[model samples]
Target: MNKFLAASVSPALYATKANARIFTLSSTEHNIEVGNWKIDSTQLGIIDSFFSIEQKILHGGKQEGSKIIILTSPNGLTITLSPTRGMSIMNVTGQDIRFGWDSPVKEVVNPTFINLESRNGAGWLEGFNEMMVRCGFEWAGHPGIENGEMRTLHGKAGNTPASKVEIEISEIAPYEIKIRGLIKESTFKKADLQTVAEICYIPDTYSFTIHDRLTNHSDYPRDYQIMYHSNFSKPLLEKDAQFVAPIKEISPFNDYAHKGLQDWATYLEPTKDFDEMVFNIVPFAKNDGSTLAALHNKDGSKGVTIEFNIQELPYLTLWKNTDTEKQGYVTGIEPGTNYAYATSIEREQGRIRQIESEQTVHFKIKYSALMNKEAVDKAKKAVADIQGAQKTTFVHTPIAKE
Candidate 1:
């Protein structure tokens, strides 16, 4: 028998608006396995008689005034999606563990316009520090002018609010809850991009899945780029936290990163004037054709694992920002269509991907927050296999082709 299963602790009780019973399982080390549902509001209209899964709309604070759609499962998985802000995953919690990070700003709302001045500018940095932010359609890095037009930091996708947002709760196998959302991103005379995001959760299970499909509804050939800027903070990213991944090669993105190549996996405490380090990773594919990476807490008691379809997102970027105690201390586990480099440079390197006129493409990423020792060991072993199979080498230069 699995040690985690054998050591099943008592079940905790949680209340919901409908007064439902949710049994949450945990271990001796305060490692919660499942979560209970507790929410009651009139904003959540009933779609069906299936009360096991709840879907509701939460109006943000009066300051931001953003509207959010929240989906809660019988288990302890909760997902918050902001339709007004391009349907980004604002916050995700599994058994009370924060799977994403929080910005210095209290209210998370989309900016009016994209700031295309510098890398860590004011406006872009506001939305850039969320849970899972989509980074591109045209560019995915520092602000620069390409083709004599100003390009914003990351891209405009994060600021482009979704027009039409839909939600549905259904069933899938043993999982009674399947939430599907469709968000539309289009410009008047420029481009149109549509995303159908799905989240599936099973009762008593500690993991969930996210699947996204982005379609191009334009007539002319369009250049597209997307990066899942998955940020993590706090308990999951302790001072001595470790990052593990099945990396085939590591390319430094800056001088600071090149200098810290020897100790890239280990995180440090937040300092006053610490420099940021960035690395472009070429992940090794497994027999299942998927690649994975994880961030484990100091004691290895808990961690967050990210799995992506290597066929679609062939590259990954690791952003280590232990810069300041106030505005820093978060890491990014990003999987994207291309490396997070300047659009001009990536295009010159033939890394920019183009879609045919009126064509579509799909991308998927899965986030799992594990609590048991067994799960952590398995993750470590998977990363170890990749390290053992290949010799990991680092490039000590700026982020570009020599």
Candidate 2:
């Protein structure tokens, strides 16, 4: 790799320079738009040519005008990100393995067609097919009336488009790539929050990290909640798949989930009209406040793990919807500051978090894929180590009073 000082150049200038290290795809503040473009190592003067980035716009029903960024890494890892949909991960594939689910919502519907207030505030489901989508920057959970306001499902962070998008690559050996986006959720006199979301990917690795920083730009204290809804299906998820984690305490979200308490960490085969089940968990962390969770296949030959800091995301929720394949059989491993309860109920339960005016909060999580049994075993051992000598407490009934 060539060693040069990192610099940003205008789109027109970058197109003519073979050594440009940064490119801006869209910027509202700068009034710049270089839509549908592609860049590779050759364009950046890198010795290796295994990395590439491409941006394209979808044209069709509900998906028309939506933009997507596809990233191909040297380690055979390909990730698709939707800039038109809050920069969420559309899907990820490594070698022959994939890390996303097949949802009934086939199209990546742009936010323009979503009516978040329709169907009693449940309109967020129309465009809910990403492998990993963010929920909340303000309030996240079930749709209901809270404090005279009709709170929509999972908030608006996932549906909100990025105001700016950029791609940057290091100019040295073992080059690192970062795809950054800026998303703002604000109101004139109510709330003002800005999120800087970045997906960092390194060469020769089957893992990626989501680094995000959220700031309150208002003049008064603000209440907020955020959850990483990472969903998975097939290959790594099946009739005998298991969810492993170092649990401190676990409880059913409601009566429906209570009936499946005995097999909370286990999954069943896809069945017709299967009711979804959810479990709230307080995970056990290591001395450094780091914890991890994994989902392994039946024979433990393949798996995936999510690693994060327990101090940043103190709660976890497991959602199992093993309905028919056509109905979108999937599971979600979510980590958040609070459980998935209505905003009003979470406030009463003292689960909603608050930030002072002009305060900023940072969060990061690593998602890795395990392609073989050895890797799967290693991930399971790490979770077991965190659980050493710790007993898990299971609550038999629903903990939240709806």
Which candidate leads in lDDT? 2
TM-score of 2: 0.95
Which numbered prediction scores highest in TM-score against the true structure? 2
| Tens-place lDDT digits, model 2, residues 1-402 | 211112234546232133325677887776767888998876778876468999998899999999999998857689999989999999999886788999999998999999999989999999999999999988898888987999999999999999888887776767778887888999998889988888998866889999998999999999999999999998888998999999999999999999999999889999897899999999999999999999988999988999999888999999999999999899999999988888998899898999899899999999999989999999999999999999999998898866
Looking at model 2, report the run of 10 residues with the lowest lDDT sum: 1-10
Residues 1-402 of candidate 1: C-alpha lDDT, one tens digit per residue: 612123323443222212222222222244533322333322234333222433233345522445565666535666776655666777877664777765675565545533535453325776555788888865676666688876667877667655433332222234244444445556777667666555655545667677776677778767778888888887788788999998888888876688888889998977667777889888887777687899998988888889887788888999988877577678999998888777888888777888776676878777887776688888888778756767766666665842
Scored by lDDT, model 1 comes in at: 0.67
Candidate 2 — which residues are off by over 4 angstroms?
Answer: 1-9, 13-20
Q: What's the distance in Å from true for residue 30, model 2? A: 1.2
